[model samples]
Target: MANSKEPRVLAIILGGGKGTRLYPLTKERSKPAVPFGGKYRIVDIPISNCINSGYRKIYLLTQFNSASLHHHITSSYNFDHFSKGFVEILAAEQTLEHSGWFEGTADAVRKNMVHFRSQNPTHYIILSGDQLYRMDLKAFMDSHIASGADITIATTAVNERDATGFGIMKIDNKQAITEFIEKPSVDVLKSGNWKIPANARGDLPAEKEYLASMGIYIFNAKTMEEMLDNEFTDFGKEIIPRAIKNKKVNSYIFDGYWEDIGTIRSFYNSTLDLTLDHPPFNFYDADAPIYTHMRNLPPPKVNGAPHIENSLLTEGCMIINAKSITKSVIGVRTIIREGSELDGVITMGADFYENEEAKADNKKEGRPNIGIGKNCKIAKAIIDKDAAIGDNCSINVSGKVYPDGENKLDNGVSFYSSEGIIVIRKGAVIPSGTVI
Candidate 1:
């Protein structure tokens, strides 16, 4: 049951960025390695898409806190030897010929050209790591082969407010890209540097005036090798613009839920979106499920008839008489004590359980055990892994629209308030009777 006509495609996931926008979260791990949807990492989206699309030979390019990422990939993805399917990570390394870190996205790919070339793929599928969306990549590759394009860029129609944040594309009736602008300003759009005819706009509403690049691309193997020969540092800022003029570049329009998790606000909002009754993006699609490192944990336990609504409670959570929880994502190994309340929160639960001896030691040292404590009220917050909140704590940010500032409380606890969403850093300890 295979499509013999389909080209042998190699998927390359770029996971090397520093993730400066998602700081604090990305402080200890790479952006792709950061947890999402309670139990999955950010890198799982692209990798799962590749596997579901019948493309098994995958390569992940990563740097900067890649140890956890490596562990997750190796432990999660292991194929049978006869299938010749594999998922591998290629970190930035120094060789006799080259001795520097990956300078940019294009550079990261260029440096790892030798490894990719060894796979002998007909076409290359390039994807970003920090985006959340589910797409059938086989259809994208089929469109690329049908178009006979040297390079095909995946595009989505966006309204005026979002046009400036993306690489806008101007395509002819034949789907050939005429011009490409990276993050064009409002004045440029008004000047009519690039325009789309009404007939060629497809299913996009008339209000959505521009086609924005999704940062996903399919390149013919030979064409990519030649393009990488040049001294381009980045794809969006450098290579793609030049390629539009010289090469047979086309566009594949994708009309689906896609969000580039680039900033804290975007990441926060997108993660919280999953708690909606009918989310734009969902993880429950059995036909194409997102895969991650599975843990052998017990089911979540809810005792004392706690009020819960419109929330995702992951495995190994113990909720004992919590007052209420609404619109939140509770991660693995979470423990919510009596009289606690959570609203619009994301608790990234503990990495490990604290045994009785550990709890005793914590009490002796005047520190709270891991997880939330009793009589606490948390609203619009993100509690990172292994955090300990003492009893009678309040982390509500009701009136603030933006962060007034961050503070480092006693016992090495760091608290950051941004866009009125409080973030308690990983392994932080908040003593009793604290309020924010």
Candidate 2:
């Protein structure tokens, strides 16, 4: 482990992706800000992970629909004024070097080398902005220095069936990565499996399963700066794999549970997983609490019947009347009407002041004025802000919201809502009594 005299660790969160998979939700804001776990966005998971890991110096790289994300960061996180370490959101501005948005994950980091230089960090940790995990990164950094390696990529034990879809690794006795394969075939190690044998590296410690890259990385300052100079744009595609053959790239096998909510089905499943009897991700741990950009809102007020079960209700939520809620995640300022039904769904209140640009363009403009309508039947759905649902609107009741349209998501899992779903966009209003 590296010495702990407060080593300078700079974390760059890649938040520029247009998550089309979680559409309607991502339509108005960037992927990270797309609401998750009821009151949080997928981005919060990573930000909180950083917070939990004792990393205070952080930079968020964003581009498409970055306004809301920027706003949320400012409102939720305010440590910048008093701490030696700070957390900030840096949007990719158009300069002579590049005129458009970030090209890819590596490009995002490459463009922000100026930020790293300004921070004068000794280590650079690049992370997927939309992943879910809780890690003690301080330990990961210590190991990086201990191995005397140029770069260290985080790895986790996974079923090959699950590992094959991710970057697989073969590490040596000293934890140095021996070989690399991206999204290998199921037959690479075992049929119906996707993990690389831990013993393949021979030096790896005992574990329950094979190790796979988690897309999290730590690089020696000089090594990362030099690698960023090339044409490599995507980390997994060009950076890590290519660096394995040249630089001393190693792996830190992580045993904790980690999940990437990239696709709609995967994203949906991650949220539902929080309801598990023993959730893989525990947010209640005071010793290791997930830090995130806070929403600066008042805690919720359940005015009417307060029947919440296996649900995550955030601050500023108003439940006018409800018999009981089972398996639901409700966002801030979200209001549920009288006699309404909600099951396995995410809901939020919309504010018009935030989307002035879109509102001016007359895009789904009706949603900003009102809240979700009274007595709307919702199930397995994701409802965005300022969206109003009419009375008695029954969304995907069976969780299959889209029966006709071709879902272009990687999962091709059709509609994200298995019990049926409906997205009201930023400002669209669902007419009263309309059944979607």
Report the C-alpha lDDT of model 1 over 135-177, residue by residue, as the tens digit: 9999999888989999999998888889998899999888889
Please, what is the whole-model Cα lDDT of each candidate in the order they appear? 0.89, 0.72
lDDT of 2 by residue, 162-240 (tens): 6667778877667788778888776775653433444543444344356778888999889889888987788888988
- The most accurate candidate by lDDT is 1
Q: What residue runs in model 1 are displaced by over 4 Å at the alpha carbon?
A: 1-5, 398-405, 409-412
Q: 364, model 2: CA deviation in Å?
A: 19
List the candidate 2 regions with Cα displacement exceeding 4 Å: 1-6, 80-82, 190-208, 292-298, 303-307, 351-369, 398-401, 404-421
What C-alpha lDDT, on a 0 to 100 scale, does residue 292 get in candidate 2? 55
